[model samples]
Target chain A: MTVSLNDLVFVAMALVIVVAATGVVMLKNIVHSALSLILAFVGVAGIYFQLSAGFIGLVQIMVYAGAISVLIIFAIMLVMDKSVEKTNLFSPNIIRLLAGMGLTFLLFVTLGVSIWFTKFPVVPAEGPVDAVGMLANLFMGDYVIAFETAAILLLVAVIGAIILAKGAEDKQ
Target chain B: MEHLFINIADAFTGWLMNLGLSPWWADLALLVVQWICIVTIVTANITVLIWLERKVSGFFQERLGPNRLGPFGCFQTIADAIKLLTKEDIIPSAADKLVFRTAPIFFIIVSVMLYVVLPMGDGMQIVDLDVGLFFFISVGSLSTICLLMAGWGSNNKWSLIGAMRAVAQMISYEVPLALSLIGVVMIAGSLRLSNIVAAQGNIWFIVLQPIAFITYFIAATAELNRGPFDMPEAEQELTGGAYTEYTGMRWALFFLAEYTNLVAVSALMATVFLGGWQGPWLPSWLWIIVKTYVIMMVFFWLKWTFPRIRMDQLMSFSWKFLIPVSLANIFLTGAGIHFFKWMGW
Candidate 1:
């Protein structure tokens, strides 16, 4: 089969995601790694856009690339000492390396098995889809319990963090 | 008058197709042309905006402003731009080279990308995505990272402090900004900006969702890092904030990007609240420009009138005041929609 423009775009975005994900893992500088993470997030968003999941794509950019990456970088800056270099060290001891390799192999096998066993749905070629509407309905209707549970979980986390912070201030 | 730009674009694409190019190539060429046109318009508009700001600030302070350069100092911004171009580019020796250099470029790119979803006239937008409003908000959020880059890369205490302040302020205000727009989205029943504009054909959302409009205005000002909320680049406190180490054209890019954002946000405000591009006498495109400028004038007025707020005060204002108000507005909007439906109006 001849490579269509869509295939080319998919390949390009896939390459970006792979390269940026690798950079996030391998980059020596924490800030650079964070930036690479942002790139990877953006590439995932592009893939979502390609799949016509516009709402999910925008949310990915907003929550991941925009908010989460900034938060990561801010945490990095706040916690790291002035010595920017040598912040992210890769120590490859035998035990650590073996553990890491085992975890990686396990993850790979799990993902591979899941992909091999899963039956993918074939989407019909149709006019534009109302992704946002479908998502809203799913969240508010059938998955309302799960959605509310996640919201409540986040609220608890926020309150817990606030109380912890305020408790520290009181001690000071 | 309504279909002027659309017709021209169609003719241009047709011309490209007649040149033996495939449909895909022609469309790509059309996209490139649109991008070029957007950049040119943004730059030209910024030139005028800068001059207007100077003049308006002069009016505020009872001064003549830049009258010496050209007629009412219209050419002053142009001259200043040229000077900035000619000035020696300086990078701090200790700076992070890549991030420092890329920050302004990224900032400007993010700012210009905002224009894509803006319905400039009736049936006028670049792509008109289903999640147009969401696209705008999400893309606009990326600019925060650019400021952080500028600050981090500068390798200066002032720059780092400024960037930290900017990130904190932007993150906080972003909540209120997004929440305030939810009311309009609820009323219009769509996040598509063009649909929101269309819904306001009868009555402006400003009247219907006044609380949303006010909260949005406040949140947007904080987002834009303008006066009273400009904690990021408080010159007296942070010495130009994230931009302290930038010089020459590098500094100019940040300036241009800020104005670009100002214009984009003002246009969005016009679209969401003031019935975008809708007027009785004027053409749709001209009407949008008029409404955008009117909103921009209010921005300018607020900037010139208020003193810069303290960082803590700015943060508290967003978290304590604007966020709660916007959440209340959303509740009111939901209740109002149900009430109207129950009344059979």
Candidate 2:
């Protein structure tokens, strides 16, 4: 199989994402986890680029890697110990872990069965890259309300964050 | 996606068909040339920018900038570069050495990457990606990590405080900085920087999105840590902020990155709002230079005009005022676009 350069880039980006996500989970240091989160975000942006979602890729990098990562780092700084300790789950019972695993397995089996049984026809309309144009059209035409809602949601988040941070500062 | 990649690959293959060499080798050659162009432009701009900044700063303070070493201090940055090269690189006694060393290099790379899609003249861009506007913003934000690294690696209280403030301030203003562009993007109906510029062939989006343009300008100023928004490195308060302990070349990297960021952001503003590379009877490249320098002058004026806002005040202003204004601008832009279409004017 002749793999094109884009395919190579896509595979490389996916590998990066997986590795960075693993690092986030496995890294002992909280700061390291935060930094790894940034790496994961960058990987996601790369994937977005491969998908030809240039605007979204940029947003992912700017908001997640740039703004949110910095916010997390600041949060890390505010915390007393920068070291990583073992996280304790409330339930130490083996039965609980077993039940959780059982539920996850059941979900996977059910999803797989449904997908296999369903004979859904692939309605070919446009390629995935055209999703950008489609999304913009929907945003202005049919999904304008939802788009406005997203803007409102971001505004609310900003307000909430400001209040929370300010309330903490006032107490201090 | 496969089809797109195949097309690009096939194009390369066709180009190398005459040479009787494998297309893969031609692809590699193309990549090398692209990278070389990117690197040469980035490095040359950084060097030129450093000199321009020193001269600008000196002129602002009513002093001779750097006329000693070379003509008009043309080689001043070169001399400074040599000094930095020879200076003993010092790590803070309690600093994390690995991140410390990695941070400056990452900072430089991020700043350099900003030039990738930036068009110096008509059809003269390195990579005219469709999402050029967003790419610039995204890559531009990566420097914040380097700043954090500088702050954390210094192991000084001042450095920590500076880094913390910088991270907070930059993140806070990003909301407005980004949201403000929605109005322009709406007016242009595309996210591509080139398309946005082309849309302004007759009347610039700035006329329609004046509020957004101003909001973006102010927010981006804070984002770039210039002047009134420069609380992160307020020497009077934080003792050089995040870079309290950086010396020699590492410090130079941070300095160069900041100025380069200023240039990039200013250039981006020109591209998005101020009729990028567009004017009457002037060459496109000359228009770019004019617009870019004009924006840079505004930055200098901003730095010299307003006093730094309190950190808390900066945060609240962005969250409370700028974000809402930008969102409103976005909505207004949507309505305005529809109305303009209806009028068919």
Tens-digit lDDT string for candidate 2 (A1-172) = 8998889999999999999987876666556677778989999999987766767788788778887656556556566464323421235688997998799799989999999999999774543654557767889899899999999999899889988888644554
For every candidate, the chain B TM-score is: 0.99, 0.87
Q: How accurate is candidate 1 locally (lDDT)?
A: 0.91
Compose the digit string of candidate 2's lDDT tens values, residues B271-344: 88888887878777778879998888888877866788898899999989999999999898888778988999
lDDT top scorer: 1
Clashing pairs in 1: none
lDDT of each: 0.91, 0.79
* Per-model DockQ: 0.73, 0.53
Tens digit per residue, CA lDDT, model 1, A1-172 = 9998779989999999999999887887778788888889999999998887888898899999888646655656665676775555576588997898799899999999999999999877863577788888999999999999999999999999888878645554
Looking at model 2 chain B, which ten-residue stretch has the lowest summed lDDT?
B1-10
TM-score of 1: 0.96
